[model samples]
Structures are given as C-alpha cells and as structure tokens.
Target: MTGTGLDDERAYLRECRAAIRRMAEGARLNVVIGERVAGDRYSAERLGYDLRSLAKELDEQPDGPPFFGRLDFGPGSAEHHGQRYYIGRRHVSGGPGRAPMVIDWRAPVSATFYRASARDPRGVSVRRRFGWSREPVALTGFEDEHLEAGQDLGVASRIVAAEIERPRVGPMRDIVATIQPEQDELVRAGLEGSICVQGAPGTGKTAVGLHRAAYLLYTHRQRLARGGVLILGPNQAFLGYVSAVLPALGEVDVEQTTVDRLLARGPLQGDDGEAAAAVKHDVRMAEVLRRALYRRVTAPPGPITVPDGSYRWRVGQEEFGAIVTAALREATPYGVGRERVLSRIVAVLLRRAEARGRSASAAWRRGMTRALSAHVDAVWPATQPEEVLAELLGDPASLAGAADGILTPGEQSAILWARPPRSFRSARWSAADAVLLDEVSGLLERPRGYGHIVVDEAQDLSAMQCRAVARRSEHGSITVLGDLAQGTTPWAARGWREHLSHLGKPEAELIALTTGFRVPAAVVTLANRLLEVLTVDVPRTRSFRADGRLRIRETSDLGPATVAAVRDALGHEGSIALIAADATLGPLAATLRAEGIEVATLDDIASAARVTAVPAAMAKGLEYDHVVVAEPAEIVEAEPRGLNRLYVVLTRAVSRLDVLHTRPLPAWLAPPAGVQG
Candidate 1:
C-alpha cells in the first residue's frame, strides 16, 4: 500500500503489457509457414486459419489490465517453489530466462490464488490483488494478504469489494477478477457430467455458466473444438448483455442463441392460445407425434415379382410382411427403419438368385433395387415431417387415432387447427407448432449433438423446449442455469427435477448458489417476499454485500415523481433503469424526454444514454446499478403471471432501488410500512 510498492507493481505491469504486445507481434508475423505448403492447399488453408485464430485470441480488451492478481510461493515446496505467477485473462510469455510473465486464469497453477487461505496456505506465501484505472489503464494500487503471516483481512479482500461495487455503464462484464471460492469450484468442475445451477438473482449464475464454458474450452480444447459448444439464453437482448464474456476470456468459438431461433421450422405467422400451447408442449406430445408419424407403415398389400436379365426373382407376401414387421420392431429412426425394410426385401431376392447358381453383378443389384422402389413405396409410403404434422392437426381422424388414449378429448380439441391451410408448405406455424415440427423431424432423423451446451433462464423452458435442447445435446454434456423464483411463464417448470427429467439428464447434479454478491440485502429481501406467495421451494439468498440502498416514494403525479427520481439517479455513477409495465413505459419515456432527459430502451443495450426505460416483462436477466420502479401495481396487473413478473422486475437493481407509485403497492412486497393507499 506504500508509494514504493505501487511503483514496483506498476513497473511489473508495464513489463507484462510489453510481453503481451510482443506475443501479438509474433502471432501476426508468423501466420503460415510450412514445407509443402505451396503445393498442398489443405495444409496452407489450415495453417492460415489456426494463425488467424491465435492472433485474435491474443487480442486483449482495452478496458482492464492484463493481470489482476499475483501469487508468491514459499521456497523448497513441490510445484511452485520459489516462483511467482501473475494470473491474467490470457497467457503472456517471453519473460527474462524465457519464463512465463502472466499465466492464464484457467490454468491449473492459478487454483491456489483462489483456493488458498490462512489455515491452509497450499504453499502460497502471499496473494496480491492489483487495482487499475481503465483510462490509460495504470496500476493505481494493490492489496496483499500474507497467509504465512496469518493476516486475514475480512470476508472479502478490499480490491474485490471495490470491483464488485464498481459502476455498470455498458454490457455485462466477465467475473474473472472477482470470482469467489465457491463459484471457483463450479467453474473448475469436471467436464464429463452436467451441472444444474439453482442460483438466485445477483448470485452470478449466468457469469458462472459462462466462466465454466471458458474453463471447459481451456481444459479440453481438442475434445470440445471438434463438435463445438453452445450457449442458450432466454432472448436476444439477454444474449447481447453477456455476449462479450467468453471472447474476453480468449474464447470465440462458443455460440449463443435462443430456443425459439433454434427450432424455427418456418415463418411464425400464427399463434396458439396459452392452453393450446401448453398442451402442445406437454411430455405426452412426444408420444403423440411418434404415433402420427409411423402410421404410414402398415401391412403389405400383396406379393411382389421382379424380372432381371434372363432371370425372374419372386418374393412371397408372407416374407415381405415379416420384413416390414422386423423393420418396425427395430425401432430405429424413421428413415433408417424404412431403409432397413428396403434392404431386407432386396436381399431376399438376391439370395434366391444365388441359390439357383446365378451370378448377380453390382449393376444387376442396382437395377433390381431401383425396380423394387415403386413396389416398396406402395406399402411404406415416403412422407415428410411437415406433411405428417399438418395432416395430424388438420384431419380430426388422424388426431383422434393418434391421441386415442394419450390425450383427452378436450386436450385433443385444444391443439386442432381451426383453419387448416390448403398445402403443408404454406401452413401458418406458431412457435409451439415449430417445436412439434422439430419433434417430428427428430423422429424422422436423429439430430447431430453439440460438444457442450449452457442453457440460461432454463426454468422458463417447457417440456417440448427441453426435449429440443436434449436432442441437440444427446451426445454431449450440459450446464443448466436458472432461478426457480424467476420463472414467469405459464408453463415454466415449478421444480428442477421435472425440468431435468424432460431434458434427459435427470441424474445431473443440482447445485444451489445461496450466497450472492451481486444483488444487495434490500433487493434480495424484497424479491424473497414475492417468493413466499408463489410456489418455489428454494431458500432465500443471503447477500454478501452490505450496501444496497432502497427508497420508496408515493406521489399523485407519477410523471413528475418519476422524472424527479431519474434526476436524482443521474447524480449516481452508474446506469439507471426506470422499469414499469408495458402500458406505462412509453408514456414515462415521453415524460422523461419531454424534460430534456436522454432516455433509451432496455432492449437496445448499445443505446447511448444514462437512463433507460425498461418494460417489466423484458427486465429479467438484466441488472442496473440504480433502478426506479414506477407503479409496481401495474407491473403485477399487466400479465397472467404478473406477480412472478413483478418478482423479476424488483430484483434487477445491483446498487439501489427506487419505487415510485400512484396506485397501492402489492401487499406481498412486505415493506416496513403499510401500503400507500
């Protein structure tokens, strides 16, 4: 903490930065160099690609310092004796004696920096955390804890506390520099199995998921780089919020998308009622769709006879029926089973020809198989998934037969399209219909799975949506992240067991993040009150932070009061979000702009403004340092599951929350005072 110490740390930081720049220069100068590269296009192309990727990975962010912490080891120890390593977002080398100047945070040696304590130093003598300013990015100060000297500062280090309390103005930043011990465990967990995180708001569940992705990519780059990893968020806006996390960690291959976009079968021109959509998303619909698709395979019409050059091959109806029955019993994919039926039927004739001492060449077999196609198509008709789904929903007979005992008459009636289109290609598909079409598509042919998938806001996924995600991850592992209390959809899973069961990973470990460092005590308490009236069994979060402020004001005129609150919030040093119901958000934005306040929207995260007017529905998976909630009563009255929506709206504040209302506040909020009626 002295001036001399600051000067020494700054000098080391400058050296590390210079090493990074040199590494970047090396990657750029030596892109593609190999013997035989001139003749072999494949090798030249691959080397070119690998070099470009390397250069891009070495590119550091312009905001923060390369390394955030330094670890000094005790002498005569085993692994890191008499050595010190600066832990950073990326590796920096080319130091004196060809040593490492900065080690990547995902490396195995950096575990001690996060795991060591006074009781068990793990051979670590001291851990030093550096504080830096982004403007020109200079080393401002440093905090050190000497474990060998038995000096424990507090529950959290001063530098970490400062980082958590920093203002939020742009997109969500990565938590690499401030990851806690408990979160570090999850981030370093093995990549063989799946993990379900039941994290409350501000518990950093999303960040934990993203960091775990980076860790897996760092640890198992070769295994994962083949099939690739995927990240699924609730919406595009939420995706944009956390889009920069992996790239900042030197990972750029992971994909981020939504469930709706993943299962987009056709243009979404029609919509189903909530009841109808819920029924379509039920687990039993999987069986219903299967039954409707396989209805095309039935008993063989008659026997078949085929003629070749100077030979006639005949197959009996009994044998043909047995082949069809065997293919049906195989229970493979629809296309595979159909091909199995064709192969078996053709082989019977080939064997009979061989038994007669006849030579069947390759050309003869091809001709015979082609000739038998018309006969095979008659019994096992070729069908498309869209045509099957359209017919099943359009024709009452097909629906009743497929849903005879699986679905009730009322449930069957709910999903039937009232106005069926003339052609299957021209059908108006809803989002739910797209999921069903995806289900049928899988039944027709199994989908290719990814290497790993991290799905956020998973509590809001329905059974059908979970099934779709499961298919994409059938051959890989998954990291499921969600808060049960924040589930706002009508069909949201009330429990993790049912949700994981539908996702085909029922044995996945379910971990709860009960201690939060993101949301403050006041906001956690307010959100917990709403959890009581609802149906979540997860425990309330205990915020590790001590300084989350809450303010409530009642005024007859919401416009002036909201404008006044925004003006007051502008005095703070972070982003301000004025969240209200959909009906009130536009008028409130007008009021703020009419008063010469620059107000943007929450959906557009890149909008250049300090104050953003966010509708309560779109407030989930987002946070602001300061928040003003205008008319809590209206947020709870705008939707069917409004109280759940209100819970999501109340917990988005990271530093402070302001509630301004003209109507009475919800009784479930449990304010110290009674409602302002």
Candidate 2:
C-alpha cells in the first residue's frame, strides 16, 4: 500500500539492509583508524569479508521490517572525524564477544526503506524494483532529542503532530513507578520550540526528561546517532547516580559530562605556549587566593571593609588607593613590595567589584582597575619600575610547571607548547571526555562543549551557570530537568521560569508530574511547611510513614551526636550515611569513625556497595532505607547558602530518616510537625 509495488518495496528493503550490513561489518573489522586509515583507499584487502556476503546476510532476515546496526570510532575518518557508521542488524547490545568493537545498533523502519528506495540497485534488483529516494524522509527534520526518544520507544516510533510515540513499545511502569497521565501528554505536546519543566521534589522531572529523550530517538531514528544529547548533572556523584536511567528507557547512551570538565579540557587547555601560560598563571593566581582566604585574616578597616557575603569578594576604593601609595613610596631607594601589592590590590578590587555595583562602563572599569594596579609598580623602589600586567602571558615553562596535576610528564614533553597546533590531537580530545562534572553550576565561568547537556538540577542553577552551559554546547542538544522549589544551590537565585527570558532559552515545554513518587503522604507533611518557598505545585499524600523518626537534639559535641546517630542505625541493622556540607566534612567523618562507630565515609560509600550512606547533596538521586541527616541544624540557618544545604538534606531520606544535631534545631528547619527529641 505504501510503495510502488510489493516486489519493488521488498527489493528496495533488501538493498538498503545490505548496505547497512556492509557498514556494520566494516565497523566490526576494527581497521586501524587514524593516519593509517584516515585517507587510505578502502580496497577489498583492507576489508576482512566480501561485501556481497555481508549484504546478502542482512537481506535474509525473517522479520517484517529489517533492523539497523550503527557503530562509531574515535576522531580520524575523513568523513565525520569520529563518525557513526550504520548497518541493519538483528539484535541490539550484541554481547561483547559477538561484536566487541562495534559501537551501537538499531532496527530499520520506514526511514530506511525511504532513504534506500531511490538508489539504483544495479544487479541488486530488490533496491531497483522499489525505485529511488534520496535520504530518509521521516528522519530529515528531527533533532537529536527527537531521534533519541524515538530509539527508546522503538525503531518504528514516529512523530504524530509534535509528540513522539511508539504504540508497540511497552511502558516502564514497574521501574519508574506510576505514570502521570499528564507526563505522557506533556512529552507528546512536542512543540517546535523548547520547553522548560517546572517541577517539585518527587515529581518525576528526570523520568519525564528521559522519556522525551527516548521518544525523540524512536521517532527520528536516522539522525539520532549523530544528534548528540548532553545531560549535565549537579556533580560527579550525581552523574553516577543517574547514569543508567537513559538505557532503561531504550535511548542510546547519551554522552554525559559536567560543565567544569568541559571547560577545563576544551578551551582552557590552550593550543599555543602563550595561551597555555596565560591559563596556567590564572590557575595559580586562583589557587593562591583560595589558600589566603582559607587563612581568614581579620585586619582593621583600612578605609575599605573587606568584601564578603558571597562566593567572591570585592575590594574598596580606599584600600586600593592606600596600596598604590605604599607601593610607590616604597619603590624609592629600597625595593618596594610591588609584587605583593599587585596581588593584594587585584584581589581586593575584584572582591569589591563582585560585592556591590560600580558606576562605570565595562571598558572604563577595566582601564581604571588596570591603571591603579600598574601604577603600583611604577612609583616603586628601583630606578627601573617593575611592570604589572593584568592578564598572564602564556609562557611554556610556567605552563609545564603548572600542569603537573593535570598532564603527565611524557604528554608535556611530546606536545610542543611554543605555538598553537595547526591540527589538534584527536587522542587528547577523546581522553578529556572521560571526566564528567555534574555540578555544572560550579563551572559556569565559560563555555567548551557538552555533546549533549542534560541539566538535572535546573532550579538549582543560577543565571550565570545557565549561561556557562549554553557556551559549552558545541554541537549537541541540551536537556534540563528540575523543580524550582527544590533548589538548594547557592548560585540558584531567580526562579527556574526566569531562565527562558534571561538566557533566551529555546522553546521550553512545562511538564508537571503531579504524583509524588519518593515520599509517602504522611512524610510529605514535614516538607509541606517549607513548600511556601517554592513556586511550583507540591501535593501532599500519605505515601510514606511518619515514624516520629525526625528528631532535633542539643548536644555539646557534633562528633558524639554523629556517633550516636550511627550507633542508632547500626543497632537496627540499618545502613547509615554521614554527610557534611563540603569536602571539609571529610575530616569530620574520619573523626567520628575514630570513636568506634561503624561509620561510612563518602569515598567508601561511592563505590559498588549498595547499603551505604552518603551526604545529602551527594545522595541527591540515590535513595536509602534509613538516612541519618548529620548537622541538619548547621544547614538550617536563615542564610541563603545554609538554607540550600538544609533543603538538600531534608529531601534525601526515603522511608526512615533521622536528623542529628549538636545543638537545638534552627527554626528554619522546623515545619508543621518536625518533632524534637
């Protein structure tokens, strides 16, 4: 009914499937790539099997519609520089033994027939009988998001109106829990524009996002392999938490990465010596500042109050003026502390600028700031004044020394840093892809590339962090998932809805998962009081038990309190996790274990063990039977930063939860029925 004739369609399908088979075989052969095969002729000798045999086997499949196989190699080939090669195949996830080297595979559908329909079969009459068609018609316009979704739903999935649906594909209600009728409808609403999902805790933001990704893959199968999809998570720990969810929905393994790793490896690793030196110097400067700030020196008000109250500090005008005067006067016969002054002055000025607004143009700000800094060296001790430069000059020696942590000695020696490389090493780029940074919000400073950026904690990301992610996307699609009310990141300021207007974000769709999946209705009561802080709808239900498990205690020592909580969980044969605000808490965990409480540290729990406890933030996507929230009181302060951490901890528990504290709970932590023990 669809094509010219039955024989013609069959013949056409045969040829198309044959080509796919040939491609698959070629991919499986593992012909040495790179310069060896980059431009070399693909003669029969280079190929392991006869093209005719490979094509014939694919055409002999008994299925109603043939399947397709897809493979990819590292950057090298003349065609795509790490391109995907497709062929019709019978199975997906072919065992490691069957096809150890192959990348991925999918089944064939209407698109395959349509694209192959036009080509001349030559002696292969099946293709000639069907007649000729250019590319796969159905898959032409679909983006990466659509293609990935389509694949998950099924190779036969299609786009009806804007939504991608596969009637044949089964729903994942068992693993995913209840399916919100609204969620299915939301994903199907497929607008040509972008959609931002505004959700609350346990609202299935992640579930919906993944379903959409699968729908896209299934509906747009042809381009799905190439359309890179990126998922950006909160941090490395969170990245690992949700890594397997995509495969569960039948979508391709979307390349996952964090914004920080992207920036560090992408553009930050400069091409030339000068660029490398500049980057290295900036890194050193940042490190030095971090160390000094850790010292927490409380000096007198020398004209300007030291900037505080945020991530970065700002210097005052008075302090700036004083430093320059001293540098100049000290430069007289005796050498002046110009270098120290330069560092201190720059630090103070940046701190002040970061705090409050300065009445000046961007250019004027840079000029004035640079002028003041430069003058310090000019009026100093020696006859020849030292020069103060605002930006670091990328010097190779300095870069080599600075790169000790990131690069190996052999790598440093092999790659010439005197000047930029005309052609970048494919290995370097490929190697850099391994480290995934989920707390993408932390690395919002600049852009690099995220094959596909899926922002898991959207509401927890600030405007600056969003902008940073936008810059990082080189040629991939971005997927963001979050509930605005669940925001606990210091950087997440404005509402998640504001992201559209602020970032000029693409057409975003709003999907509300009305059902609460993680917590029971009784447990929901505690978080309901804090729901006032969020703008999204958070329905309460008695889904989980309110075991009078939450307790606030006032103990003189946090260590003993943590020990007591651990002892309590272990007494019940329950797994216990002790979490702190940051890595600084690493020591706290160690000290507690020293007290002979069966405590688990972050590193110990992060591995393969299932019954282990982790920090609230680190435990973002993970769920446990018994969660002992350590230092909830410390995180419950009215301070914006503290509130975010507190929120993160409160929402982490699944069935049983205990809030341990060294002091009385903060009023901010208490909701309607938050009991004190």
Candidate 3:
C-alpha cells in the first residue's frame, strides 16, 4: 500500500469518529420530561440514566481510535456478503434503523476478523489489522492478509506482531487488536457455560476473561442485566490495573472487585497466621458454620398458648413439635425457617378461631404473628452471623459441638480464638473470619446472585473463597482464570479439578492457552525451570514472541546492582519494574532515589516514572516491558511458597528480565540459559 492507501484508511477512521460524535450528540439531545416520558419519577430517572450511559459510550476516547481492524466479507457470505466493515470495541451507528458504521468486535460478523484463515476463511475475503501511534492513538500503518491458498495462521501480521510486542505502560490495556484465535474462542464461548482458563504468563487469560464479560453483556444484554456481571481480581491494585478494559470496551455496568471486599462481613480488625487462615478457609468450615447455626433450633419445650376474643387457647408441646419439624424441613435460610415456625403456630390458633366463626383477616394474622414472637424465639432463637461466628470461635464448647467429625482437633485449635471479645460488636476478625461470617450470612439470609463472574488469579483462592464466588453464581455461570503452577498461597488449589469442585462448577470446560504472545520465549523457558518443582502438573507454554531479552547479573551489593539495572532499563522504551522480596522493597526504593533515580511504586500505575518498584507478593497479575528481579533467593526464601513467588516475579517481564542476584539464582537455572538477546 502507498501513501494514498494510508490516507484512505485515515479518512475512514475520521468518518467512524464523526459517526460516534453524532451518535453522542443525538443521545444528548434526547430529553425525558419526567412523568411525560416515563409516567413515573423512578422510570424517568432510569430513562435519564440510560441516555447518559449511551452518550458516555459514544464520547471521544482521548488517546485511542474508535476501531482497530477491518474485514471484507466474501460474496458467498450471508447478509454481510460483499461488504466491508470496520471492527471496533463498541458499535457506532449513523442513526436509528441505519446500519452500524463500525461493528462491535464482539458481534458475530466480526468473529471472522480474528478467526479467518485460508483453510477456514469463514467467508472472509481480506483481514486487515491497523497499527496506531501508541497512546494518543493515530493510524500509523495497516497490514492485510488475503486468504487464498493455505492457512497463514502461523505467520502473524506485522501490525499484530508490533501490537503484541509493544511496550506496556501504566495500567494494563485491552488486547482487542491482537486477541489470538484461541483466546477469541474462549472469549466468545456461551454465557451459559463456565470456562476455567489455565494459562501461563503472557497467554492473555486475564484479557480473555475481561473480553468475555464484555462480549456476554453485548450478546445477552437483557439476560445479564437482571443478574449482572462481576469481575473479581486477586487484589485492589490488580483490579485497578485492568479496570479500564471493560469500560474501554463500552461496558460500565459490570462490577470489578476483590474477594476480600466482596465477602467483608466482619469488623476485619484481626489478623491470622497462614496456618490458621488455611483452616478457616477449608471447605469443612462451611459445615461447621451450618451446624453451629442450626443447633439453636430445637423442639418446642412447652405448650403454645394465645388469648383471643375473651377466650384462651392452649397447644401442647407434642402438637407444637410437629409444626416445628415441618418448618425445619421447608426452611432454607435461618430467617425463613423462623418465619415458617411462627406462621404454623399462628395457623393452628387461627384455625381454632375460624371454627368458632371468627374471621382470619389480615389484622388477625398480624396480631397472631406478633403474639407468637416469644414462642417462636424460644423454638428457634434469632441470631446474627456475627453472634454465631463469635460464639463458635470464642467458645470451646460451641466449636467442639459444631466441628465434631468435621474438623480435626489440630485444625480446631488452629482456628480457636485465644482471647474472646466480650460481644460480637467488640470482636476483631481476620480476612478468613470475615469469609466465615459471609458464609454464616448466606445460611441466615440468601445473598444476591450475579449473571456471570470472572475470577482471575483463581489458583490462589481458598476452598472457602471459591464457595463465596460460587454462591454469587448459583443461577449464572463463571469464567475462572489462573495458572495452577503460580499458586502461592498456603491453601492454593493443587489442581483445577479441586478448584472447580470448590467453586461448584465441576462441569465447566477447562481451557489451556499454552501459546503466549506477551512474554518472550527466552523468558518463558527460564521460568519453566521452576515449573518442574511445582506440585501441580502444568504444561510449558510456548511463546510466539521469540525475541525476549534475559540478562543475569550477580553482584555483591544488591541495592547498587538493582539501581544500576533500573538506570539501564530507563534507557529502554515502555515501563520498567524492579520486583523483589517485600522486606527488601523499602531499602531498595530509598537506595534508588538516593542514586538520583525516580522509582514508581506498583500501586501507582499512572506514575510518570519510567521504572516502578514492585514487591514479589504484589506482582501476581502485573506485567512490564522491562523487569529487574533484585534477588531470586530473597524472593524464594521470604515465604513457604517462595519458589512459586519467584516464578511469578520472573515472568513479569514481557521484553526483558534482568536477574540481579547477590546469592544463587534458583541453583538449577543456569545463567543466560535461554536469553535470546
């Protein structure tokens, strides 16, 4: 293509941008005159919100282009035959009843843009990928792949390759332009089914999960809107890093949160040892909580008596027992069971009144319901989740009764509170305890459910955490994303089978994206050395990015070496991250600043500094173009799962990894073993 061709592509882009502006303008002009438009104030507010949401989607993207690729359909295709369509993150149309100027990448017709090949063109004549000037996006170039002979799938377009190998900066960006065919398959999978993507670093599993969420919302808008969609990340930082992906794809209704924040039911002023936390997060704890909660409900101790119409009616313990038994059988949450108990007792008294010719009106029922409150409380004492959890954790007697035959003696002691608080209000709880409270809350009162949940870094989720995620997805499905080999928590899943079983989605399809385009082949090979030692059986990932640089520097001074590496890394394009043990990060940051180098903390993704200092514990879901692993031994020795932690740290680099080790570098991995550079 010549300069004229480039100019033509730019013109098309301009048209698409203009179309979006007009659509937004039309939305802005749409006025809902309160009751006149929607008949009610609530409906009118809803109408206003919808209009604002639509307008926001069409607003200008300061730095990004509206569309990234284009597809020309063959004459043999369906309605779209012999037509050219621009593919973008969101749909942009001229007006009502008008064809879209830019079709959403999630649309069915746009699937060929990602999946077309010579062997299986899917009626695509030409697939074109656009290259943009990074950041404040401007069309720089474009490449075309005309499928005529054989599948050139193995040969990637230069534009796609450049986009894949492009330097990563700030927060993680949507990889819509370079989403591989394998990833697209997982992304476009049916919303009815859950998929567990077990992929190594740089496989774009996180992006696939986010895009799948956006796609599901686009395909099944009304269905998902009722139950809603949620994206759960390992930490708030991770959530922040990937927060823009969904909104960039024109989705704002979907929720992004952490498991801790989602399951926060306690004061959470407490801390727990890893062993204690592991015990609390065990699946057995669910049974323990259930038992503790239900034990308060028992057979009626005495007769139930109520006074009505100058007459007294008395019911025996035996008769009350029958009603209680039936109520227990039908009761789901504790509150429902209590209500049923009250209703049955009230019904018996009301039946006697009706036989005497007294009406069973609404007033009569309300009076009976209130009159039987004391008896109902006696039969089944009303309890809060905190009350149940506090008693179980603080009282040895309660713990023994609930955990009998469920948790071992050692496990019981591990979770036992040494000094109990005076009451539930004064109780201090750990994250594990908070999760337990959430479980108790579910058993007490049913929580709301979501249409779909995407849990990233799922391998680190404990049995109890999986259950929390599962409860939100009873009516919906889930998209589980993680690398089992990277599981670094004390209670991390040994395999996806166990993880999925805990999530209550044992039937979900498990997909592995072993071919990566983000991390370099050289970096992957070096990281693979640690995989052999992992308890789980994980396949080594192949990286199409064959040009990653790996440098090993063993220096006597750890701080000085890391500072030097960051200095050199600053000379490169894209973001640089210096990741090491959590304990060493403080001194390292101070040393870097002392040496006249400005260091950005991992939390500040938007920081202008070229280099960011990261702790290995916080590097699970982050990536950088240039990464400096300060000391492999320090990262591996900081925790019980240090080797896994080091694996995560080593794989954070997409373009370059410099291992600055004062001590040994994992002992097994030879220096510069697979350094392509």
Evaluate residue 540 in candidate 3 and report its C-alpha lDDT on the 0 to 100 scale: 93
Q: How far off is residue 55 in model 1, in Å?
A: 1.6
> What local lDDT score does residue 657 receive in model 3, on the 0 to 100 scale?
89
- In candidate 2, position 64 carries an lDDT of 28
* Candidate 2 global TM-score: 0.47
28-59: candidate 3 lDDT, tens digit per residue: 77744332578777888888888877766666
Top candidate when judged by lDDT against the true structure:
1
lDDT of 3: 0.85
Model 2 Cα displacement at 550 (Å)?
Answer: 3.8
How far off is residue 146 in model 3, in Å? 1.4
lDDT of candidate 1 over 441-509, digit per residue (tens): 998899878989999999999999999999999888999999888888888888999899889899899
lDDT of each: 0.86, 0.44, 0.85
Candidate 1 lands at a TM-score of 0.96
Ten residues in sequence with the least summed lDDT for candidate 2:
384-393
What TM-score, to 2 decimals, does candidate 3 have? Answer: 0.96
> What is candidate 2's local distance difference test score?
0.44
lDDT of 2 by residue, 293-322 (tens): 211212224343232334333445566567
